[model samples]
Target: MDSGVELKKFGLPSQCCECGPQKSPALCSAIFATSICPNCFGMSVTPGTRYHTLLNTNEPPDESELTFVRSVASTVDASLEYLDHEIANLPENVKRLEEKRASLLSYRVRNNAILSPLRRIPPELLREIFSWTMPSLEGTAEVALCIEQTPWMLTQISRRWRVVTFSTPSLWSQIFIDYRHSHINRDPSTYSPSLMKAQLDCAQKLKIHFYGSQGIDLRPQIDMFKLLSQHSSRWEELSVELTAEMVPILMTLRDRIPSLRRLWIQWSTVEDQTGVHSIDCFQTASSLVDVGIFNDYRFVPVLLPVHQLTRYDMDCQLEEHIRILKQTPNIIEARIDIAFDEEVGSDSLETVDLLGLRRLYISPAGVLKYFKVPALEELALDIYGEDILSLVRSLLDRSSCSL
Candidate 1:
């Protein structure tokens, strides 16, 4: 007997209805008995075989194939039940794997945090790093109080940062605030008077840069000023823009401010340009080194111990500048914004030689003709009028300045 035709002894069909030419067929589920297994096919499951042809078509079989067809169906149904049980477990298996993956990710993050260099740094060094984030109040930008500012923001980052920020005095030393918030109807959240008080309390010595509206005065502003004035002895640097009404309040600082080194004051009024309100509060600032007074119209006047000043800035007439410059013989740097040139003959005027002056700035051309600064190294001139170069050259030649 031929080996390929051996399965025919079981009287099985030779052709499958799946492919008409009876290509290589399979009986993947052929056996159904005590053990339902495909291997019980008794021959290889291939094309042109009895079980392959019947199972592929699943059509009504001839009477001779009826028994074999029912056997294949029972075996397929059992295999489907096994697959149904496995499919039902898929969701739980996926959920368990996902939870395991999340746990590993969390563990990795915590491990990395433990190894971070910042955790191992000294607290003093870490606090110094935080202090570098403090803002430099250069013009009027810091005049408005905002909780979002860097110094205030540092306190909110974490418990460690908040503790470090509170201990660093330089972070709180610069207190800049405009007492004119009520004019704009600003939100209370935009600034905090109590926070300013807390800042003053935090720093040992303070640099107070205060500003306010030109005309309007509020009780809160007065109270804040008074509160700051109480610490006059601790003021290292003071800059303010004041009106006539604030003059008496500043007079309270007389015989009070001793640590004051740098002072700048601006008159905050346009209505009373001719009215000069003088306060001798800063005359007691014996340690005062640098003074800046913008004498636009002299509405608010101040007195400083000018003899000891190294740097002086004033917007004044030529005679007034010479008068003040004579007093400040120690002045090394001076910015004179000439209000108007005096008509005095050059021969009548004594050539004022600023012996130690190294840096000089002046405007409107004629002030240089009066100054003989032998030590002048840098000269900034806002030149006007004809023969300005000749005027500068005359200043350099007679003074023998290196500028």
Candidate 2:
């Protein structure tokens, strides 16, 4: 018979020989049982010479050629059957290697933990080192963002470090709360409550600096103020910028802040001129001394016990500064920015003697002539106006203070 024509009639194997051994055997066996013998199907061998010659000469293949093909098919099928059994065990080998790797990693971690030098440092010294990591107050925004990071990062370093960082009250005492810096987009409630409680728990005395920004939600700011007010007795030094809506929240701390000493308040907006015109929050704060008021002209009238202040800083109209100086005779140092309004005329104003004042920083050099600082030693004036020298000479003459 013609081999080419017979091969076409028998057809090729249904599955590839390269397939994994499990599927290959059944497919190979079925192909071998068919008219195509196993040898031709598995090895894909060329047919005998008679089959090759038949293409050119039209000769038929003898029975011997058919017998040889049958024998080869049987041997090839046996080899495939054995190989399929070996391939099935590969998954188990892979799993064993993975388990070995995991065990090694676990051992390495345990060994490294035992040898870590950081664990050897004493708790006291470690706390001191953590204290040094605190950011300085040069940049308010940067300091505010880093506040949450300093104590948090130290605690995460190790269990021992966590204990040390939490125990150190000074690390948490100076808190910088900037609504614009870190929590610009997040709701303040997310981090405020837990952070405030944690700080309060760790610190005995708090120096809180709250920096506000425009367009932020008022609720969070008000909430923070309310929370802080609850612990007003622990407030040692507080510097906060308030919007019109948040002004009332601050006023709630009136007569309650007995421990307040240094106070700094700034108004973010001027729309509600009458709202904070009289801030009596620290009216009963006997410990209050150093005071800095920015952008709020009405702040001076409401501050109680101004006579006890040792340092004062304010940006207000000329007459208001004079009014404040008249009340604060005990002030040792004063920084005043004079805004010349129509009400502040060159008409002779009363001479207020600051008998105890040592340092005076006043804007508009001419305004110095109006003050009588008898003990003033250090003077920094924003030198302007035509008769600055005459003003200085006149002030020195009136006070008899050596410049």
- Score every model by TM-score: 0.75, 0.66
**How far out, in Å, is residue 353 in model 1?**
1.4
lDDT of 2: 0.72
Q: What is the C-alpha lDDT of each candidate?
A: 0.72, 0.72
* Candidate 2 minimal-lDDT segment of 10 residues: 8-17
lDDT (tens digit, per residue) of candidate 2 on 105-180: 9999999989988779888888788888987777765564333478777888777788888888888888777776
What is candidate 2's TM-score against the reference? 0.66
Question: Which ranges in model 2 have alpha carbons more than 4 Å from their true place?
Answer: 1-127, 145-148, 181-183, 186-190, 272-274, 296-300, 343-347
How many Å off is the CA of 215 in candidate 2? 0.1
**Count of residue pairs whose backbone atoms collide, per candidate:** 3, 1
- Residue-level lDDT of model 1, residues 148-256, one tens digit each, is 8867788897777788788888778888866544633454234476887788777888898877555454555666778889898999998887755656688888889
